[model samples]
Target: MPERQDPFATLFDMQAEAMREMFGRFAGTVNDPAEADLGQWTEAAEQLRTMWLDFVQERMAGGGDPANPLDPAHWMQMAQGWARSAPFDPAAAQRMMADGMELWQNLAGAMLNTGGESAGEDDREKPALPRQDRRFSDPAWREHPAYLLLHQTYLMLADHFTRAAKEIDGVPEEQKGQLTLATQAMLDAMSPDNFIATNPAVLKRTVETSGQNLVKGMQHLIADLQRGQLTHTDAEAFTLGENLAATPGKVVHETPLYQLIQYNPATPDVLAVPLVIFPPWINRFYILDLTPAKSFIKWAVDQGLSVFVVSWKSADASTKDVVWDDYIRAQIDAIDHVRARLDVPAVHSIGYCVAGTTLAATLAILARRGEADKVASATFFTAQVDFEKAGELRSFIDGTQLEMIGKLSPDGYLDGRYMAATFNALRGKDLIWNYVVNNYLLGEDYPAFDLLHWNGDVTNLPAKWHGDYLRDLYRDNKLVVPDALEADGTPIDLARIETPAFVQAGRDDHIAPAESVWRTTRHFRGDTTFVLAGSGHIAGVVNPPAANKYQYWTGDSAAPSLEAFVEGAREHPGSWWPHWFEWLQQRDDARVPAKGKRKPGGRGDKVIEDAPGRYVKMR
Candidate 1:
């Protein structure tokens, strides 16, 4: 392995280069870089970049073989050459070469150890166990010589290629990311477990079913084709306004762009400051209101907080022209509507994911115009204001890529499937191939999970707004820089936001990495609470106190870095909801009668519709 380089020599230089490359790709012309299509290629490669598409294509050709086009070993051979070609890379080639030597030597040792072994042989002669992966969890993988050989061989190749792709030192960061994605996708798609011939469990299941599972698998494949993606859950098991978003509420205000649903208070008294939720239009709002037990909205109402949520209309021809400012304005409109309906000077607000990014901007606008008092406090869930650390999602955000995807959709709007594919590709192991093996290979039933159902219910984005948002946030990353971005003629400065804010991030969240989410403390001027939640984006925020499943951490919200924060933090059992509620109480615990009527946002005596209104039903 090579020694480290001096920070004075390359850290800043590399960052500058990466930034230039990212923005260059984003700002380039349609013909820019000839790789303008790289983003689209990466998106399509999500199937293979992340490993679903190539695996499917190979499977269509019948059982797995060494000559499979997407084999990890084949890609690993190419990837090793990439490492070796990095002339300026300090030790990248040396490290990879040494690693490869170690891998082969270890594998050879394992083979020699296992040479004369048969089933249930002496433990001393057995090979070293492969790394623990769910894919190799079947006992037969370790006990059966033939399967064990394939399993260990695949793991070694996967590790070698995955490492080489990740450490390729000479390429620009974006290109490196794409290559890494492509490499991993190949490895994932060509895993032994994915093949009927190589996987003991799958092969056993196939034989037991007398190949009837293949028939079931064909039917499942056709269903996935019709559904347009692998089934993550039993979609038929859940429905909105019933088993799903069943929280009691009424759609009291309606607009072509949004429906404002005001929840009926579960208690006789509710917080004086009404609570309005701003969910990202990228997903339906029902995510926060899953089943009653899992529903954040229902839980908040039960905690004596009056709740309202904005249900954004799915983008179509009517919404193609809605720009970034429009979303900011719509959020302000909702805040004002809540204040007017509840007869309160201010209300508390919550924004999740992308909506949270816009909310920070809205607060900046309000603060700039001396209207910051519109909201009493704010909370953000797994939201990112800076995109530099946004993880794999950033890989698909260059300028040409954005343009190419919208061109494939109506009125240049981004089809939800593209967004879906991008996200699914990020965690292909869990999101794509796991389901592929289970449903299409094993012919098993998909789990009936509310989260997966909501995940599948994706929303389209207006092309203008989509491109603008990604450009400013992901491409340019202007939000964290004061006044770097402007919305509706208001120069946005996040530091201008003086409202007390609570920022929660998932420790393992890939979309909005914890480090990125926590750094918002640097931007806001107000009192801020930063807590790290357990699990990924969805489970982290949607966790109900009753479930008591995951833990959270809090310490120096003012910590300079994530590691520093962890060093100073204390782990607390259960959800962060109670802590947030206590913070809200400290701000203003004043209570009002749950207003006794479900018509808080109603005009005179007319109710617009039931909760989870028409706008949410658009898809």
Candidate 2:
């Protein structure tokens, strides 16, 4: 690789650009000859200095920890400002107030109805009143009128606040996204569950445990503090090769960029066309091959499909200068290796999350070079090619935050743990505080959840590659626009992709909203099947038919908009996996006997070790 440019310098340049946008002039030295206001600049500098001093003084007064000077209260105040600035809806507010009053009245009536006497066996067995919101469902909470009032009022106000934020008119899309994120974050923080006094369950547990819960919780807190971070999982409970990534596979191919793990086939006959999967490098590829029960790779092998997965090397100082081209090359190299080993003309391909986006780009590059036929079929799982409405995650992608993070990095690579923490902030109540309460306050061990264990295994983002990805895909959205993104000296276009396409989106995926995924259908001018799966991002994709869980939606017609498509789509009873496989079986040729061993000099590249390669074990 060429000499790496200083990320700090790039960050400084980005910061300067933002400052120029804000102040209408550059700082330090004014270069613009058109306008110069020395007096105004001096006054602004003084004001900025005063503001900084006030912030520092406030932190000192609050008994600053130095590490976490910005207390919860300070963030709450910022949230208040964001909420207050959102557009006001008087009618919505009035309805919320009226509902709050009615809720209080009903709670009082319910309390009176219970009376002073203890309930009989039948009465005790009776179910609590039905509530649409699951967060407020508890018999103890239902019995308390004050608790109900507070909960109902908070819910009512939060509902209106969300609506009001969406109703904000004449704001830039980025500003509107920030407001939506701000409002959501504030509401999540103010949840009744967060407070011991308001949460009947936590309070009851505290009393029942005789304050031992608090003591245990404090211990958990102290342990995390000593580590200088939050504990994501009970790491001691699960081992990678043993319990987590236990799928049977061989490392048939390896590159500096990725490891191609080829799973042992469960069937004697496999599909004529082999399958290759490109998973997001942000996390371990084991999410797809987490365990035998949930592993998609294992399922694919069982279903008589030869599977190959690209396990991207976790970024480090040596790989920090790796660019997007390197990732694309890995995908291409893996595909060639699979094709060569299987001796197939073309192979079926799948991409998940960021990997999907990369795959799409790779396909475009191939299509431009008249090699599109290399991939017989393409499938994207919860991936966005067009990010016009990329959801709440986009709120943190502003140039300012990106630059700050870039400058703060001691190494050229961005820390995976820090990125993981940012994602936790998006759903703080569930990801962060739930653990804080269960592990720290209650002094209880978190259950051995395979998914959570897999989640804790994160991979760092190459500073240069990740920067390109965020700016091009999320910031500029160059993929959808023709000739905007160039790969391998060719301007790749999404429209050029006319292969049989299957796009799957999760209904409740906050990270990559279903609507954003749906938009990709418009870009592909081929036989496109868009399936709307139920549940959040990871769970929705990992869902197996055996689970008898989350339903999916399919449409005979591709409606212009997501709303119309959803309304017209027919609901299916089980996992979307079966639906996708059914579609895959048709496109794939007749089955052939599986090869007992991989081809010698597979794709003309040397085989490294067995599956779940050494690179994956890198910290």
Candidate 3:
């Protein structure tokens, strides 16, 4: 007959169409945008019921359950019963039918004990059992039969869709990952918690507040729409150089692309070599210097390493024409300038995330120029030079998506909001739906979190810079290939960079998987040391020694795979900072006078205003 489309593709298309229609209606009613009504909500909910009913009926339809035709419980029960009575099994029929029957009977009994929610009818008055999910953690969700059944069914459907995506055969690996994420995003969006009618907590709050909570929620929603993204944190809570990125430092160097800040040393004497950190341009550099208490820059400076951080300018019309070559040249120029100004032969180098990828390239260029010693040592924090094992993000980059993204920026750059959205998609439940439920659904203020405030503080990417990164590094996997990529007309290779390198990654990092970070050891033909920290991307890297929160693991560097590395690794309690500090001491323990209260500027100029500078204050 006809070629069947992928289930995830069909599901995604339906979801997109549904969202478009829903938004269209919602937006059309927003003349006095803050004034929202339940009639419209009821209409949308009915549409949702119809849409979901059609989708579910197409998959499994038999006994019509009027209580909720969209409910998956009845269809799921029918499907389970069918599987138990199937004429053929994936394996031989011997003992399979008997096992299936026994399993089905047990499952049916369990269902009965739970009041048989499978029939799509439940007594709302009777108390229901508690279900454990952060979204459904509120007691009302567990105590009300309607809500308890709703959340449980949603969880079951989420699991079923997830497992279905995983089990789909013959799909390409990348496509499969895309399918899995897409299914999850859809399922999360369709969750009972996201809808006021379905969310018991939201409904309870609305009733208690006489519907004022929804009016407030509408106001918040309108404001967020105007801003063009979800509010993830208390926006008014933190300001750069006041409470956040407030480390004592001054701008020493400035370029069209970035401004370099040199922190006044905390110690009387510092290491012989200065530490220059190249943070990812995709975000503001202050992540390394969020606050004095949480600042890695402050920690490193206190450890006697003269610290300098490069604060990248958020790309706009001015830097829109910038490309990869300019970035490499600017970095080299910065390194050389620092060496010349400090009268030091070389400085210690560290790159975080994308900056690490480019730093490796810079090192390669230095190696190609026969000046490999320009960098005394290199450290990478959650940085991926090898993309073979790159995380869930890699799967999102394909020919079509890349091309579409290339056109998204009319101003010759990709907006930071898109990047933020993508990152949020990676952890939709936590990053997206969590905020939606709390801020919009429950009419609650976003919690005051410095890191989240930093997260919401996004930076745009130059089109060329953004494109080159996605294609060369992620999609093409060209960085590890010798001479496959070039910066400033020099074909560079990671293998050529023989500088002693230190790579640290979070074991649970979603953006850059530890396995991929570990693979950097193979590509860099240097005495590379790899360390695994206990958290995800930001926390793993920003982990301070004093806080002593998460643990890190150190292992034999010769271990071929991450699993092998972990197997032999010893777990140490607390942050990885101490281990890294010790590692830095091994290379250059020689002491020199710290650059104390001197004006943080170039060799000639008086000063570049103050620390945190003017650029960081830009939108």
Q: For this target, which candidate reaches the highest lDDT against the unseen true structure?
A: 1
lDDT of candidates 1 onward, in order: 0.77, 0.74, 0.75
Better of 1 and 3 by TM-score: 1
- Backbone N/Cα/C clashes per model: 3, 4, 0
Backbone clash pairs for candidate 2 read 217-440, 217-441, 251-610, 251-611
Q: Model 1's lDDT to the true fold?
A: 0.77
lDDT, candidate 3, at 269: 84
lDDT of 2 by residue, 1-619 (tens): 3343333233334334433332331122233434455555465446545655765685569665423311244345435654555666677778777765665455444544553123243365544442446666655445344455456657777887777677778677777777887887778777876766566656566544445566566656655644435776777887767777777777887777888888777787888888999999898898998778888888888888888888888888898778888888788888887877777889999999999988988888888889889999999999999998898878766786567556545577877766776677788768877676567555686677888877767687898877787788888888899998787688988898888889999999999999899898999877888999999899989998888888999985378888999888899887888788899998965888765453222445456676787877887
Which candidate should be chosen as best, given TM-score against the real structure? Answer: 1
How many angstroms is residue 144 displaced in model 1 relative to the true structure, after the best TM-score fit? Answer: 3.4
TM-score for candidate 3, please give it.
0.81
Error of 2 at 559 (Å): 3.8
Off by over 4 Å in 3: 1-131, 595-605
- Model 2 gets an lDDT of 0.74
TM-score of every model? 0.82, 0.80, 0.81
* Residue 249, model 2, lDDT: 74
Greater TM-score among 2 and 3 belongs to 3
In model 3, the Cα lDDT at residue 424 comes to 85
Q: By summed lDDT, which 10 consecutive residues of candidate 2 come out lowest?
A: 22-31
RMSD of each: 13.9, 17.2, 11.7
What is the lDDT, from 0 to 100, of the residue 600 in candidate 3? 54
